[model samples]
Target: MKLRDELNNREGYQEIIEFYTSSINEYEQEIELLLEYEKKGIQKYSNPNLEIIKSTKEELRNAYYKILKSMYSKGDTIEGILAIYLKLISYFTETWKKSNGYVQMLEMLSIGIMLKIGDKDFKLLIEAVKKDDPQDLLIDTLISYRDENWKQLSGKLMWNKPYKALQEVIFLAKEDKNLSLERLHKYLKKEWFRGAVEIQTHKSKFNIHSGYWSFESGALVKILELDDATLKDQQYYPYDMVHYKE
Candidate 1:
């Protein structure tokens, strides 16, 4: 089948195409205004020490949301919404890579896309991002989403099977003061699909002590290093464990 025919055969695909085609001028206008604000920020804050003003950041965010809502209201699927968001991010980031507020704008826009897409659509969203983004935006966005979800989980880990065994380790740490990296590796190998490699790599990528995952809530929690000499210190010395709310 032809590509156009293939796309048209998908439910809601033609509507999404029509929506973007009709709204191209509007999208361009918003993007142009947003880029103007970004350029102004770059000129205003020549010194690397200085940050973009809050108002300028808010303007960029508003422009992004305006376009986002437009596409969302057109009744596209979550995958379609993600495609729209990625295109916008790609366009804006390429246009203003050095703009003081560019990364901040992308961060805000990406998170909003995830939340709007919701946890139930995470797999579809990630796949769309992986397919479209070449600059590792999906990796950054997923880490951010997972971190936010962790905070919402409080000390309780997600109850899904992938995390269930890890939760047992968390429970043990709560009961016994701390958990060593070795012990975490053991449970991760047993339970997590990607096992220890996935989390250890994430630890470095996110600049955290160790581990990152998300849950139903919208906040992120970080695992921190803990050591109590009285309890007994392993070779790793301090253990990595879930941070308590207190």
Candidate 2:
């Protein structure tokens, strides 16, 4: 098969990564604007509506999808696409979870920012992302309706799978005295929320959950790493990681 054909045949993280890293150049301006807007406080785009933001996201998503389609069809390198996709996903995740005076907006933004899944979740979300499942149906309906109660809806929508995953780990830490509520809020602000915001455990199952928004992908649709090293190598360590005990 030709190179483009090969790329076309690929899917999930591999394909997404390929499109993102390779397409970063096209999105450089968008990245800069997003950054500037965040720094300036969206003063120019003042009444930030959920629909408008979702529309913008959809437009960009389609653009990337189209580019991937065209490129892969033409036999091109899928390299470099992943990085760009990761960055844009991060931006969207961060922007979506901010508090702009709306309650439901705040909740949906929070859960979506902290969305996760185990191995099964990774596969399911990845397929949905690829357009096979009705995830579009759920997230689209939520964004279209844009209600305050949608956060609960999100929990039901993801079937409380990833939510429980996060809640389980964090609750364990909280009860164990490894984290705080404010720190938990920090995790909610993330694009790829983890539990290591202020602490890390010694277990291999899950050592740390991050409270920062990842300028990378969300959706635990797949398990990436299964080791304490992820926490050990964290660039920023919270006090609970090694300083305290219950």
Candidate 3:
């Protein structure tokens, strides 16, 4: 069960890891709920707390569809609507910095859709993300909207699950703050989270700051910086290149 012992064997490494990491209570509870539903028995979007998240996902999908509708209001065209979705995905990714959870969810959603809906829709999104500027639209109205939402989500409760291997941000997301940051940070530092972290940056920097939405002040928000500097730190990313803005 020691880390070295497990990784030493190549035959059943994955199976061993899954067995040790999986929890009993959570797994059983989720499985029971699925059986009760008498459905496909897939355990997703089933977390009790995720009900609101599911609703939020619906809202975003509706927003994307509406954008498509407006663009094609004059006359419905398949290509035009596809163009709108491609732009929407880029805009969505450019803004909406909430819990790192959003990024994982969006990637999963994009992948799932591409598999189900076919490669045609997938191509549009791929084009948008690959090409920085929209060849189709001169103006990006979503730019402002993405910024506004980013500001709002910044203030909400968030998680700080970083990648130890990559040393980059991973599952940064929000859930009700049942535990204090200190408690959560301690929990993360424990050996269990080391594996949870895929990688850390060359900077070897890791920290979490607690901030909230400041509607009235409209100023910079500050919070406790809970990270330590390490010699192994990676390079810092410039704002313009990362922010998806000119």
Best candidate, lDDT = 1
Model 1: CA > 4 A from native: 1-23, 26-65, 72-76, 97-246
Overall local distance difference test of candidate 1: 0.37
Clashing pairs in 1: 147-220, 148-219, 148-220, 151-220, 151-221
Instruction: Write model 3 residue lDDT over 134-177, tens digit each, in one string.
Output: 21110121121222322222222122332221111111212222
Taking all chains together, each candidate's TM-score versus the true structure is 0.24, 0.26, 0.19
lDDT of 1 at 70: 37
The residue-by-residue lDDT of candidate 2 on 187-227, one tens digit each, is 44441235322233213243121112221112111112112
Best by TM-score: 2
The alpha-carbon lDDT assigned to residue 87 of candidate 2 equals 33
Q: Model 3: how far is 216 from its true place, Å?
A: 36
lDDT of each residue in 1-101, candidate 1, tens digit only = 12211212333434434544555656455555656767675443453312333343334434443344334433334455455555455344333322243
**Which 10 residues in a row give candidate 2 its minimum summed lDDT?**
214-223
- Order candidates by TM-score, high to low: 2, 1, 3
Q: At residue 199, what lDDT does model 2 achieve? A: 33
